[model samples]
Target chain A: MVVATNSFPGSNGTTFSPNDILDLEKGDPLVFGAYWKKMSEVCTVVIKGWELMSYLSDAKNVCWFMLSEFGDAVRRLHHLVGNAVIQERYIVVGTGATQLSQAAIYALSSHSEAPQPINVVAAAPYYSEYPSEINVLRSKLYQWAGDAALYKKNEPYIEVVTSPNNPDGVIRQPVVKSEADGKLVYDLAYYWPHYTPITHQADHDIMIFTFSKCTGHAGSRIGWAIVKDIEVAKKMTWYVHMSSIGVSKESQTRAAKIIGVICDGYQNIGSIESELFFEYSKRILRERWEKLRKVIEQTKVLTAAKYPTFYCNFTNESSESYPGFLWLKCDESIEDCTSYLMEKLKIRARAGQRFGVGPKYARLSTIGTEDEFNELLERLSNAD
Target chain B: MVVATNSFPGSNGTTFSPNDILDLEKGDPLVFGAYWKKMSEVCTVVIKGWELMSYLSDAKNVCWFMLSEFGDAVRRLHHLVGNAVIQERYIVVGTGATQLSQAAIYALSSHSEAPQPINVVAAAPYYSEYPSEINVLRSKLYQWAGDAALYKKNEPYIEVVTSPNNPDGVIRQPVVKSEADGKLVYDLAYYWPHYTPITHQADHDIMIFTFSKCTGHAGSRIGWAIVKDIEVAKKMTWYVHMSSIGVSKESQTRAAKIIGVICDGYQNIGSIESELFFEYSKRILRERWEKLRKVIEQTKVLTAAKYPTFYCNFTNESSESYPGFLWLKCDESIEDCTSYLMEKLKIRARAGQRFGVGPKYARLSTIGTEDEFNELLERLSNAD
Candidate 1:
């Protein structure tokens, strides 16, 4: 069997001529046949097109509940938390959660009377792309000739944090309260129904959600924010109208339909099938983590970080937690873990420094099936 | 049957309940029972006790492209486009066309080395929401404590012009060249393979495209952009990553699939049945436009911008061009034509002032089917 390399190579050296079209099996999930199949099943009363808009437009009663299906889904998602609430008075949807995040920062930073520049802070060993998100914000400023900067300790400004953070997958709850108290902009991208339920103590801050991660339908590209404050929601809506013309109406519709399936006991074959997929992934990841833990302990070549309990390192601690990542810190001398892994082990993993972590460590996602994970681990072991 | 109202009045008449669900179509588009009636049709491959993540991990390729049948279709699309050369060097894709537009602006405006703030200028009587797009950019500056006023010009710094523009349906192919010189951004939101090609003389500053207008699959929010400069592309990529995590993998795959089916001649369906949908939409649109044109001429209530011969708008006084938009100027004393249309006739059209056109003029769309178009004209006649 030919092994797939983890690199995007400049030239194809493999004789196998990868990406050759092969006969496809009808049952393949990758085929996205399932959605079509599910569509066929739900086409009965469920197939009503554009009912949400009509419902909203026709409502002669309280306007709070007349949201389109997608809007309803968002409302339902907010309701799932029980602590959260929705309506024109309390909530508004954005093109994506990203729009809301950027808008929230803009609103806080741009308010006429802010005493200082709006400083943005995320817990170290957090999502590496936070900087890039800020970069987009900063780039906007650059166009406008605005001055923005990253968050620094001792600086009085807003802070934003991502829980179950990317790259490291660390769950940062209550620990962020210090920043939250400072009226910092917080991004709880993953604190949702299916993900870890960190019942938020505060309500009126910026919280981000996406159907992609929680619902497993990444292609829909739908994300929203739950702002407890109505004013913030209104401002966010303004930003959205200016930015992307609003989210894809169709995507919102699809997300709303899928949310309906999930809420109604997830009756459709798609959600049921999706549940199975996640279980399998978790089982495989758990197993891989067990093996990975063993390898790290046995090899003793390098250890993991303790704080954040993630696959990434932040404070140079020696123990690590697996939120779904194996953040391994190899010898400190290694400048580029990406090149080393590709050149020596033929193992593909993310270089840590890209994420603000030191270059000594690397991040490997255990996102594959157990078999694939085992095979990859086997390859790594063989290389070692 | 309930008459569709623009806004629903709640019981007390203070709040608005939505009353236009049918018009918006916010839920599942499948139109169940009408299309997919059976469970077997919906239930193709049961993923057997796995969750989405599990299925994702265990899937053969662990790539969404390799997972679903629709995913398969999208994979084909990616391969098709990925294999092609864009501007001779780069291959581009976006969450949808809108994201690319916003991203391109971010890259171009931020990277300019000039001391002057970047200016965003759009042609007069353009998309109603160009100001909002500018707002998003302005908000970015606010986030950074930057002043966005630097970019504003009596003639906007970055000019946004559309061919076959919305509200008017004026196909301004050759005429757009006047604004395409150094200070403009082109919104080719409506440009497609079948429509008038505007890119022939397209200047290389920035351009945007969307699939909803072209593909008839607005629900599947897939759009893309092509940038001539690589540096701009890189910066756009950074912002995109922070936006929606590179769009939806599933949607991308499906988009790819749909494109493949089109290119390969859609299988599992006949050419004639397939031909009906396309033929019907076009026929209906043509019929509507003819009726609309007749009514406008007969009413003589307002004048539309001239439609250009060879898609060129003539500004030379002797030019006999009439564009598609019914750009009406209805007595300048009437400050807002949009409000006047709503109050007097219950007709809804955008205020021309929003597009930098002075008030008392409104922009109307000719996108509806012929029957709808005639109905709109009849309603206007009755209201008048």
Candidate 2:
């Protein structure tokens, strides 16, 4: 799931300093002026019909949970996804997507009998934060053995993997031969109502999604987990309970209530705000993906896989797939394409070695909005 | 810290069903209609320029650091002695008091070289949920060794030992000798600018606090932790990092922004709402305490040590106190006070045995506002 770079391993180290990944840096999200302006619209939706005078009166409905309570609306959201059978069986709410990712890790790591160690496995060119999630799990606080290097042999364990995975954004189907009976902990943090559909139907996988991209409530911190197995779901629930204390009750109650309203079909799903968020997120990603695809196509550098799923494995001269992220295989003799690109363009991209993919490949993510994406493309294109 | 009932072990199983705690909960703050109606005034000082449109814009400020935005005002609060030391050393923020409590437990139980098995040596008749905190820590996610009824010796430890405990409103100072190293975990959840003097120096012990009691933002779920020892503070910070993906970032940032205005000079500390909440909270506990104290005084049924603290040990007939909570001792001949009170009055009080305080003693809480307190007094007074 998207663990923010601020949570990087050496963040707590004495010499740690903020960088592009860790620090939003020129990111409007951190600029209170812009955020506060947008928050006004959010607040209007948040607290609409409130009247100060009514509270002085003697009314039984003055309690937090009244007929008009936000929680009532959130509970109704289940009906929107008509396919979601047995809501409790398939869903678990989280404070945010990041939380759900960690909870999924905790659940997979904990299901072992006698508190044994568990291995977290992700495909190459994975989410930069996957390793950090491992660090958090192995953190003395959560106390699970989260070794990120590789799956040690002869160990009976649970393994975490991502689908429509981070950076590359490619939907990966497990190689049937290689993954005979190994457990797969899938991270589908980006999969939502309109994104690419996940294909791995293995019963032993847990998938995560977030509202930041799916909905426009990035600041709201709402996310959910989809698990097919009931036992795994139970463990996940327990982990959520133990870990977050509980997801923000205020957030949860409100989300459930709003979702309840939407699901009941009482409110129009095509509301302006909702549609705006969806279109904004999807359009930005679509444009970035297209631009990156064109770059690879024109340069004749790395063979491009597909448009939506841009992953192409490089050869001896270069290796690693270029997906949602442009995984570039920088050569030692060529002054390292990634370092050169960064110095020349002021662009920031993750080094693939961090993702257990080796030192040759460097990854660039599409986290920026449309404007920033355009800027990044122009900067990168002009960089010799 | 005043962990809210919204957390694991703290999840409000007391009311909502488990399913509600999971899939049906919301993950957004209450903004519109009934939930937000008239609620904005509750933070008028903190959220200045009281126009309704301001809330939306203000909600954005919730993510920014308060000191950075409102440095001058916050400096005023520094003189008052709450956990306002906002820095990496002494201050750390949480999603709610519940989050900090859970984090503290994790920090205590998961780190250390020869980590001894943990034992939470809470004083008698403390917050009833201490056991649940223990349960969460011992759960598969956190993986410590302890139950409400039992404890392990090798785990790192967390002893809740609250001051001005729940159910019982008595303020308690440790009766037993301190650790030779003088390490103590103190929960001053309610000792605030409202209940206790803010200027008084807090004992050199680990402490937790919540906005619910003092700041009247129970729904917002913001809290802070104060640790005398720096190393323990760092460990707790790490624990917090691993929990809730870092405390809703939104809530803490909002708290940082708003706290200054609310705590302004503590001048309007005598505001109608503050007085109402304090009197209501205090009068209810005072009424309940007086009834139990009256019963003990009249019947001479218990020989509990009379102290100003939230608790007193029932040295004679009962095994605990009747200060904040009415810990009644009833034998076969005498009615099991808790059950008897519940069965006849349709009211509920915790069974003392739930607190590891053994059977025979029943603990009853002082719940709700003034009127509810009066109703409870009538119920208990008429209970023979």
Candidate 3:
């Protein structure tokens, strides 16, 4: 086991590679995956689309209950991506996938007279925010019971399975397979063609998706959950109505426009080269991952997540790892990889402890500006 | 006392006055207060403002945490309206004021070890959705404890004071005046110049405001709270972060633009007539109220909410009742006013029972289109 260290080399006479030189004073852009700026030219149409006379004039687009246009857009995007089955699924819009995640937990939990608060669990190395988000309300309907691997109760529980998982970038299924009935909420926020291969069409009881991840428009804050169960969908819708009186109509309209653009690009694939959002995003993500992998391999300070090659039905080709986040496991000696990277290299990373894992691991966001990605590569290459 | 009857005229040789006729089947626009179409000409400039190239190019505006533009706009609107003091308040944004209301409830509740779930109460004839919204979460931190007048608990509780209250548009103060330490959350959603007289610069510890009611941009779904206490503000912000990972950035930008337009109109008051949103809205609301009062008075089936004439600081005149919703009390003989209107005249109104009030009262939204108001008036006048 290679021991990872935070200590700087003091007069070791080790020559730094020219490629390893990076400005440490400048902060790392490994915090969020908002890649809007990277595809500004292609997304310019979205801003221009808002100026249409019908955009503001039509009250028909913003029905208080839900916009059919938005629902249709969501359905279209799923169909275009070929990641999730749109048919026989009720789409419930949320402020974001964050809201939908909690809504799913609430929907799955028992709401009977003798209310039993169901335990909500996710596999280890989960999305960092899930635990806090679930427990924030300290709700009586459900409680965050930590990692699903440790969840031993035979009672009904909710297991969140984030495919192309947030920090780790691994396709996951429910770990808590039990004789007891359990509800699985598939967080397919990163199941888009840009992030991963569409190995199979996800047809879960509850699956959540967001425009933030799909189009790198995190600012839009539009998310939807495809639910097979009508009762669960109704419950989720009720939760949304009670929470925020429904999602933002403005956001929904923008999302619908963006989704339409994406679909249009796919439909006119031979006609558009640089304008195809999915192709552009996938290429950028793949390149960034490849560059980071090459640099990190040279340093040998951290090991990245290895993904098995899968044939993508959407792209009609074999695909490698193109995750939004690069999950890095620091060499054994690094007690806290996040602290090591920050203190020594001035590179901020989310600690694995946040994701119900030990401190030897950290997660870096791969979706950022090209300049930021280059700077991240320079810093990581100097890790040794 | 005259009784409100659901009984339609059954060939009693009663001549139907053509002057008192209404196109009832044409449908009422009482559903939404989206005034985008009305202000489209002035707001067209806003849509065009997005085309300045830098609008979509600026990734800084869509920060993950909070937008300063939104915060500044909130402050400017309050200053422009002169309804609330914003100098010392920390502004926290929400998906809508609906979200902030629940956030305030969550913030006010206990977070201690052996957490005591506090009671949440609003006055009788309160906002109709308060009960359902509060209880839907079924949170351990707080529970919907019904009418504040009947609330006998000496323990800690939260009292929601919705000035220019929803359903029944009456300015309200906290009903539960307990010596026990209780927090007051002022839901000033309709305290804008268009809805009511700016009685005073409301200096409350916790005050909530929304762009939906003020600017008639219900589709934007942007609401904010001016919280005095640092801890409360932090908690509210955290709740927002966990609830939806913050409000939509697209909504925030739109709100900021619309608010900027409103403020600009105020700044250039003499130059424009119909372009001013607040002035236009106030005139519409005032005229609609007058028309509604005239028709309802002649019918003698229901009585409207009475308001004391107060010297307005914003408009500089003694303003009459210009409520968003007309709180109509049915005659003593009538049990359900909502049912009576719906059954007899195909008119739908919010049931009084939803607001913890007697079935003898109902609420009609007066902020709808001119056509809806006219139809409602014609139906009410012909009610015998």
Among all candidates shown, the one with the greatest lDDT: 3
Residue-level lDDT tens digits of model 2 in B192-215: 433433334455446776644444
- Separately for all candidates shown, the number of backbone clashes (residues 3 or more apart, or on different chains) is 88, 61, 2
Over A12-35, each residue of candidate 2 has an lDDT whose tens digit, in order, gives 222212223221121112111222
lDDT of 1: 0.46
Best of the two (2, 3) by DockQ:
3
Binned by DockQ into CAPRI classes (incorrect, acceptable, medium, high), candidate 1 is incorrect
Share of native interface contacts present in candidate 2: 0.15
Interface RMSD of 3: 9.3
Tell me, what's the RMSD of every candidate? 9.5, 10.0, 7.5
| Cα lDDT for residue B280, candidate 2 | 37
**Model 1 over residues B72-103: C-alpha lDDT tens digits?**
44334323323212333232355555666666
Candidate 3 — which residues are off by over 4 angstroms?
A1-64, A269-271, B1-38, B45-64, B269-275
Q: How accurate is candidate 3 locally (lDDT)?
A: 0.71
TM of each candidate vs. truth: 0.69, 0.69, 0.87
Q: Write the per-residue lDDT of candidate 1 for residues A37-117, one digit (tens) a residue.
A: 344344212222112211122133222221366666767655544434454334555545666777777666555343344
lDDT tens digits by residue: candidate 3, B61-89 = 22224567778888898888799999977
